[model samples]
Target: MNELLLTGDERDRAGARLLALLDSYERGLPKAEILPEPDRDVLASLLAAPMPERGVGVDALFDRWEDTILPNSTAVAHPRFLAYVLGPPNGIAPYAEAVAAALNQNCNFWQLSPAASVVERSVLEWLASVVGFPAQAKGILTGGGSLATLQALATALNDRVPDFHANGLQRASAPLVVYTSVEAHRSVDKAAAILGIGLDNVRHIATDSVHRMDVGALRAAIEEDRADGLRPWCVVATCGTVSTGSVDPLDDIADLCAAEDLWLHVDGAYGALFLLSEEMRGLMGGCARADSITLDPHKLLYASLEAGCLLVRDGAKLRDAHAFDSSYLTVAEDPLMTDYMDYGPQLSRNFKAFKVWSALQAFGVSAFREANVRTLGLARRLGEGIEATPGLTLLAPVTLTAVCFAVDGASDDDHTALLERLAAENVALLGPVVVAGRRGIRACVTNHRTSEADIDLVLEWLQSRLTGRR
Candidate 1:
């Protein structure tokens, strides 16, 4: 037998060693540096090295991981790192991720992964219920919001065009047009361009003063497209814009799509999960009106990377866009078992749903809701703190968890320096946002790990920096 196949004694020793390393990680978790600068030369050498021709034993591999991989990666889990729309993984996430990997469930079809199939369907059904989608709603878990939006547009194309799959973009008789606000995520334009909808046809409709999509501009754009002999096919609305966290007027946009006989897709990837909190239901009530929606559980639900979802009101349409007969992988769709391959593009898929579902099951929905509510409240508090400070000016309305602000009398350079200084000092890791033509430091308090104390600390750091500049 090959030495690679470990005997009973070897297996036991390896297991014990692994346990010790994991225990150290668990014990040192709290004291670990929030952000550690990496030795890039060492990292580069490891990355550039040829895949070793010979096997490195587990003991050696773990040592390399502790010294290299763990330190080089960004520590998004640090409560003080308030940048971007990312969330720290829930406590159960790592364990669930390991379990899913061990099981190695191919979540494509029911027979291949019976429990995974049921788990995925169950998760989708629950998400649909939260969005108030009816019994006919269906969805597939995706890598992230961008992929979900892209897939949604693909489904819309299949539904609207008579021969999209058969003769894609070959005929130019009536070109399709897509409409979205200027503040919408770039994913909308990307999808249109990929679908051969033509960049010129994508109308970046004007936004209102607060950055909500202008309903009137949308109407005029559709009319202008019709007059110009262009096909107005769909509308992509944002629940929370990437820059200022503005929610495009979803109800009005949905009405326009209906009037124009076009598909309505809501990019709710960042904001939709906020629906879990009772405080956010009214603000995001319009999501239910969308024919299709994209949501990111990884961002808000605190699942590890790569857990996003796309829900369609008419779930059958998702299958319509993607389903194709494959003789080798045939399995009749059983009511009890969902053949997820029919729902989206992939036939071989990892069991992503289990990680998300496991988190929800372990924490319960109410805990997530409370944590989201707290994050929202903290953002508002930080915004208020910025407004109260004499030198700091609010850059945008704190509509959600993103707080954008600029230090008074500070040039763009000053603002950038301040941000970098805070990050380097381990005070906080915030990002930048651009509104109209002006740029400012932005903090997205989306992590459940963050608290009011962390926000106050960041605020104090900003105050001291502002004082020093004077």
Candidate 2:
């Protein structure tokens, strides 16, 4: 018998325990602390423990997970987990992940994972349709938004820089410059740095009072770069910025990129999937005009973490940038399938698509749309509540689902203390933000489980604290 293989009875017991654990966790999510204080001694013991010479068996393994692991884990699925852009997994996510692991599809080539490649393509095609991309558009799932942006910039370089494959950034007559709003994700700067575009060449254009990218400022920056003999190659727009959920002027930015002959990449990791709501289309519809866009299913679709996407309007360009000739992996092109290895940087990829696809299939699109709409409403409610509160001030407009506010006359230290207090007392887990240099609290409604009652409870607590302090 294989040493790693579990006996039939052991496998049955393990399955039962797994199901019980999942059910209990889901049921207990509402009561669980959003951020529990971890026991350092227990963690240290885990680190210090040695591997056993003999097998621990299924029951012992489950005991370890229940007694140590579960107690220490963060309750990201809790309704009050409104700190960052992270979202809880959909109900189907765990089961989908388990099945995906068992299948163990390589997902690189058609022969190795025919069904998985098709499933991934179906998911991508559906996403492209939601963004209103043309049939020629193509994309690949990434580890997250950062990697997707990096891949997009790399594709832009290959497409714009002549003979880039043969001579990458070496012996160039002038440095290539990229443009993005100051509110854009740091991933843009990171991508530029990694691609040898250099951070110095990336211009963070100013934003307007509402935090949207200042188009005039961006245009002037491009003109200045061109006059300086630098190559202005691309513009990274933000559909939903990190701090304020502010969407840059995508239509204006797209027009500028077209006139200047620059590639347009929209980083919609935080907000693109908001398009699932038809009501959000007017605000975010300009995403289709981009040459490429980055999206995070893990953020909005509430899939398990580490699933991002980069969709390019011109499928040929993405292929031109990433595909390479390989002798051992050659296969005739089939219209029904795609060799994912030709799409992006990975030669060995897991079936990340399965979890996403499974969730969509199980819950249907309408469920996700309703969930998004609900989050938007809850955010609006919180923003209005903050505005009406005596000691609070709205730091930014409620654009999507992020509400930025501050306790009036509070210092940065005060805000930090308030955040710690909220988390410690289980009032709500909130993040601290500095909007335009004034430190504040940021409550982002990314969790589907978050409700109007949850928002009200947090607001009531904040109001009382501010009143007492005053």
Candidate 3:
């Protein structure tokens, strides 16, 4: 086991190799492919290889990564990679991640991870302030937005369901119903199902022309369910819907949830961070009224993968949902630090906040705000361009950083072919989306590396393709 630890020379060599790899990757990102079709033969070889009793040494492993791994990976940091609401990691993320890995802190209990606990708390505090949540707001870092939503639902269960910990939904008298818009992410339904709330009990409420959840329809559904003797447990509203970037009427939904005594959770995984921009506050400030909100720092904060958060208005409720005591893990509480095991589902949690904190500390919040504002501008530009183009149709309002549009008189296959062609030619990697049964292409300006020129190039390509000139 001791041999697993590298000597000082080995550590130095590995660190130097990693730094070189990072430098080369940053320099080559401009010309890199946004999407790379992997070689199945190479992947098959990796799968078939047997584990050796002895390690192959660090040098050989680094060589393998350069040769077999780098080529097959998607260049998510590419400037023109505008498929999903995914952002490239900030400049300092790699260094922070490396440091966190070396520290190997389990951010579960305060005594075991005092400094990590404070760091995570600091990050959560800033996030809460960003969303305009009250000082009492507290949250836990999660795997991603999906997991955050799941945890939010779990917290709601503990808060609303009588004796949830004791009965665990097995002794429920009436079927519990969850309400969300049809435009909401599938994660809502998945969470409901996983939490023993049957899919049949979920009401996919109708949306308006802009794809926002119709509050009237939601209210009517809740009333109908109540009349039918079913319990309306929770409402999951989308701050930025995945399909069209439509924000559900948060204030109206919050009012309804309050009156009905139902939990209100805003899935702001894609759009919540937009609150960083002063211009976005009006559209998203209503998120503060939600009992809980899900945010993905990895999406808009430019943090590396696997950084999502769930913030609850009443912090104690979140702790009640997941805290468990064990004699073997007994530890004294500290006034300045938090035992994060009381917050969410994980017992052994990684120090995920370091990368986010490091990026913010290195670049400052103003830098991120500027980048986000720019992405919003680029999205609006794309929408305007699509509307101005002779052969294209704007499918949805350019809200947040997602611009969804379709080619006039084109079928789903036509849009698919265009996507494939553009990706093959390295013009861009746009995603496919369907709004109100209309299939179209969606370009989300979530990449900090994306520029106005890149958007222009994509539009130019589409125009050329439409005119049969390419």
Candidate 4:
């Protein structure tokens, strides 16, 4: 037996300590600082220290965590943490994560993790159902939305370019071009650059007045690219742009993709899961028509960090793009389970599906749907507050949970200072955004913990600040 293995007593003590720590953290979340101040000296000491030759024991390690680590960590679960598209983890996330770690199941192959593979399949099936994809749709859990989009592009490349696996992009005669709105996430550009689809080939088409990708502009751009001897390979539509939470016209985009023989990849990372609400389905159901779609459970489903999904309309295309056979890792296929290694880049994958599955099983789907509905209501409330305020101006339509507004006569510097002041004062954490060359502040009410009181509190503070400034 390994000497590092803890005895029963030691394990008990460690478990007790960890449970206590978690309990304290949970109890304090409502009152904790949204962003903690770092102790520079302690941080520097940690950076300068070398790894200890021997273990410090569980008790000492737990003490170190409470003293040095916990104080410096951001309280992302705080009710007032409204910055970015991130949300607080669901109530059962920690337990699920701990159980997953304890199992330490390698999800690459069914032989190595049979139960995990089934669980992952179940999760994917539910996600596919949520998007209204056909029974033949298939997917894999990814690191995040960015990786999902990357994998989707890779799959599209394989489908569009003949012999892509054997000759990777080097033999293509015409440059492949991708079309997306200027409001699309940067991940698309990053993926294109990484996949050797030169940046110049990406057309950042203009958006309409409401910030959605203009289908007319997209069609014209594709035609222009074809005239310029570029192969219009794919169209990436945003299902909730990061800046303004504007969802592109997916149905129109899908129609164009079909007409042009282009792959349609929807970057639905920030807003896809809103389909949980029957009301949102009308706006986002068109995602099901895309050749592929990216969804971030971490953002919408409130799963712990590092859980994203990629769904392909045609399962075979995804397998064709990524599947590879190796003699050493030969494992017979089982009808009951999926070998996730044949799906994406990683061969030693963690069991990310467990947390997502556990959260759904624990809270039920209706709970999430209600929570999302509440967030949408809160965003609308915030938008109304902004409009009612004297100096605040709504930068874009409050189409989803993200509310972007500009302070009249405030420059970029003023917004920066306002954000800093708000953070320093523990009012709320809002992110900076740029919309159509105008700088502003963005509040994304994706956190389920956020209440109407919290929204009113922040709005009242802003209104008071503006009043004092005048």
Residue 142 local lDDT, model 2: 91
User: Which 10-residue window of candidate 2 scores lowest in summed lDDT?
Assistant: 461-470
lDDT comparing candidate 2 with the true structure: 0.94
**Better candidate by TM-score, 1 or 4:** 4
Model 1: per-residue lDDT, tens digit, 41-143? 9888987999988878777777887778877878788787788899988988877988899899998878999999999999999999999899999999999
User: Model 3, range 358-424, lDDT digits (tens) per residue?
Assistant: 9889999999999999999999988898999998999889888889898899988988999999999
| Candidate 3 segments exceeding 4 Å error | none
Runs of candidate 1 exceeding 4 Å displacement: 1-35
The positional error of residue 259 in candidate 3, measured at the CA in angstroms, is 1.4
Question: How do the residues 180-260 of candidate 2 rate in per-residue lDDT, one tens digit apiece?
Answer: 988889999999888888999999999999999999999999999899999999999999999999999899898999999
Candidates' C-alpha lDDT: 0.88, 0.94, 0.92, 0.94
Give per-model TM-scores: 0.96, 0.99, 0.98, 0.99
* Best of the two (1, 4) by lDDT: 4
Q: Residue 248's C-alpha lDDT in candidate 2?
A: 90
Q: lDDT of model 3 at residue 11?
A: 90
lDDT comparison, 2 vs 3, better candidate:
2
